[model samples]
Target: MSRPPRHDEATLLDAAVRLAAAGGPAAVTMSAVARESGAPNGSVYHRFPQRSALLAELWLRTLGEFHDACLPVFAEHAEPHLAAGAAARQVVAWSRAHRERAVVLLHGVEAFGRAEWPAAQLRRERQAARRVRQAVTGLAERLGAETPLDLDRVSLAVVGLPLAVVRRHLHAGTPLPGHAEELAERGAIDLLRGGGS
Candidate 1:
């Protein structure tokens, strides 16, 4: 008998993401992932012991990827406002390039039952949270207290505004407008320049 090709964890996770994107979290069963990926049910189960594990892994992995993409932008721009603009641009650019993953992120962890995730996965979530907090704190420190910027306002300009811009398209299942990145960049910069008023 011929053996089935082994599908790696990424392939399986990719399938899961597609399923979630297409039909929401309810559609992401192991069998559905196996069917979507053209892998056997056993293969899906082999990588993810249960649905919760799969969901947790997918959510965490997606967040990790987004955070990873943005981390370098801070270092790339020494100025806090420039860095904020970079972050806003990154949010739009990343979402445009990876709409499916972006949808999952917009839906957030609660959709994937994050509260019930296993202990280890919860730890992973906490670590990701720390990285995000650290990035924000570092940026705030660089901006300095004398500056008009504060963590709350900077966050709104860099993260909140960009997310709001993308969330509309993702929720509607529409392609982001061609001007999305430019608009996001301008909005972030203008907000910061205006002292976030």
Candidate 2:
């Protein structure tokens, strides 16, 4: 019989996230994660070769959760307008539910040093970008707007507007209002309808 490893990868990452949340990314060194997680330093290195890898994993993991929560709305709804609203709502809703994760995500690549991320992590980021583009394009066509939908406008609607709602509360270290999701939904619909610009 074999004994299971005491400090798993998720444990170390969780420690990293907490450290990052508490003291920012600068506080997330391997030694620090080990101490924070009560794991051996060797275990931290086994899961992540360097601090950059840890930062990359932290970034990718949080964004992955965001995409998982948000993308299904786009895939499931037939009405582009409703789908747009739902996606926006989902963004704020997810952020509100995962406040610490939201804070990390709101910091973005600047906190993680995008240039230092490994190639595989960069590819995942690119794939996420592609998916967002495809969803936006498809939704624009479904809406049948008179003007062609550019990436910028769609971004403003789907990501920028919703993010604004989330950022205000997250930055202030306050809980978001219960109506945040609904407000985001309306903002996204208006932006999509070409009335919010």
Candidate 3:
């Protein structure tokens, strides 16, 4: 049998994540991934035929991982309000636990050259987006979100508010505060409860 390859796709993608986290999406070129991962340039090319492919894979993987972490939080809780709170808290918790990936996520798919992604990547991206939309809709329905504004509020509670907390701390290059999870959880519940107005 031929010798096993040294650097795998995951290793190269991880290197891309680090590069993107440190210098943004523009930093994650093929050669840069090779250098960061200590893999041969050929290995990087073998795994990702082009820079756009690498970027797409990196973005998709990060998004999938994030969903994996947060979706279960929504599913596990019996009460919609409690589920919303836990989901919000889980966002902060996931970000803190996966700072580098979170940084990559903050930049988003467009920054990762989504326009240039191959058809397969685009399909995968759409599937992930649909999954999130479905989850959000289910949660909103369970929360008795009746109007457009009510659905918007649920979206804010579960996604926007927690992301705001993560974005603020990440952009500032500061550690997420000790109260980050609590703040996210409380902010979500408050929004869901009509902001206590």
> How do all models score by TM-score?
0.92, 0.90, 0.96
What TM-score, to 2 decimals, does candidate 2 have? 0.90
Clashing residue pairs for model 1: none
TM-score of 3: 0.96
lDDT tens per residue, model 1, 6-46? 78889999988898888899899989999999998998888
- What clash pairs does model 2 have? none
The model with the greatest lDDT is: 3
lDDT (C-alpha, whole model) for all candidates: 0.86, 0.83, 0.92
Q: Per-residue CA lDDT of candidate 2, range 28-114, in tens?
A: 899999999999899999999988889999988888888888887876788777888888999998998888888888887777888
